[model samples]
Target: MSSTLVVGKVVCITGSSRGIGRACAIEFAKHGATGLVLHYFGDDETTKEIQTLKQEIEGTYSPAKVTTIPGDIADPKTATTIINAGVSAFGRIDVLVSNAGICPFAEFLTMPQATWERTRQVNLDGSFYVTQAAANQMKNQTPQGGSIIGISSISALVGGEYQCHYTPTKAAILSLMQSCAVALGKYNIRANALLPGTIATDINKEDLSDDAKREGMIKRTCLGRLGQPDDLAGPAVFLASDLAKYVTGASLLVDGGLFVNLQ
Candidate 1:
């Protein structure tokens, strides 16, 4: 049997300029993904990073093509743009990693309505729109199948003191995957959630910079350390590969045992 996972497959990963998305993009290429469609929020810094990432991946993995799209995930049209670009470049999209999101920590009572609304629009609503577009493409394709990996968080299962608005969006993403699994299974499309636990990424850099907070999360993990973005790459690969063909509506916690270490 071929040991390579996702060979010749085309993958679309949102927020792939950095963090978990970046790690997954590189891993997928290393494991034989033939094409990559990377999405990022339209900012000069991220735009540059995605371009560099495209060069690095394509150069390192010869013959593997990469397409970068810059847009706000909060806008529904961004999702449409990403899918169309992927299909135009690769003929089909075999996998989608819905990983673009934000977490602006704030106390519940004092949080601004704008904060709550923006988080909802990006995290929850964005995932729905992107997943829907991907699922629709997967359904109508010749093979009639694809895999979706939603980057949810452990906050979906537990609450955060300062993440009242953010947590709900993550939970909703988890629920969205569950429903998509049911709705898309008949078409051979698999939907699953990858709930990461405090993975060290740009998203939580300042929050983790606090010695007390950082150390506390590290100690809480059974692994004795915080998770790196690369930690979730393997699970993501498995889910996107045939290894997880039977896995759908499942929530895989890549937390370094943090969720189970509650004691």
Candidate 2:
């Protein structure tokens, strides 16, 4: 594929202020995406990060416009605002990355209702809302097509001791992509899932802080190291680019072989 696979394209990514989403945002700009709509949670820390990200992208990748929107992904209205912002600024959205999510580690038996519901609302419900909005825009746009990438996790395929509430949401994201792929094929709108395994992100910072536990995870990967957010950025770029024109309803694992390291 060419270096500028996504050149001239406009991309939107939710939860782009940090973690995998942040890395993907930078990669997209480097790959020649002309416009970026970055969605972030409206918190002081993330708000600052989003501002910094905007400057970094626009400064480094000159002419690549960046628009940052702060919102609660779990709120359905937020999805509308994000998609609309992209269209208003860039004319149309060529790629949608439903990456906003939360995973509060807790045991299933003792998990509070609020924690479970919040997880589902943000991870699953948020994806549904954003994807629906983007699909509609893509369907009615001049080009009449776009790529939708859902950020899922290896937990979708396997169970985690403290991720019972979380895994279901990730699993739902994968299923949503599969269904969307079939539903939007005629419109040329591709939907797919990217599942990462044990990526070193804020969500798992405390969990990985334990040296022994972190080492255990690293040992499980064939790469002999924990996955980094940048590790998933290349796969994300491919999915959004013409390189993956024929790819839809697919689940690409960017797990550094951890998923297959069963012993």
Compared with the true structure, all predictions reach lDDT values of 0.94, 0.94
Clashing pairs for model 2 are none
Model 1 C-alpha lDDT per residue in residues 1-263, reported as the tens digit of each score: 12379899999999999999999999999889999999999799998899899999988986689999999999999999999999999999999999999998899999999999999999999999999999999999998899999999999999999999999999999999999999999999999999999999988998999999999999999999999998988899999999898999999998989999978
List the RMSD of every prediction in angstroms. 1.4, 1.2
User: Could you tell me how far off, in angstroms, the CA of residue 13 lies in candidate 1 after the best superposition?
Assistant: 0.3
Candidate 1, position 164, lDDT: 98
Model 2 global lDDT (CA atoms, 0 to 1): 0.94
In model 2, how large is the Cα lDDT of residue 182? 99
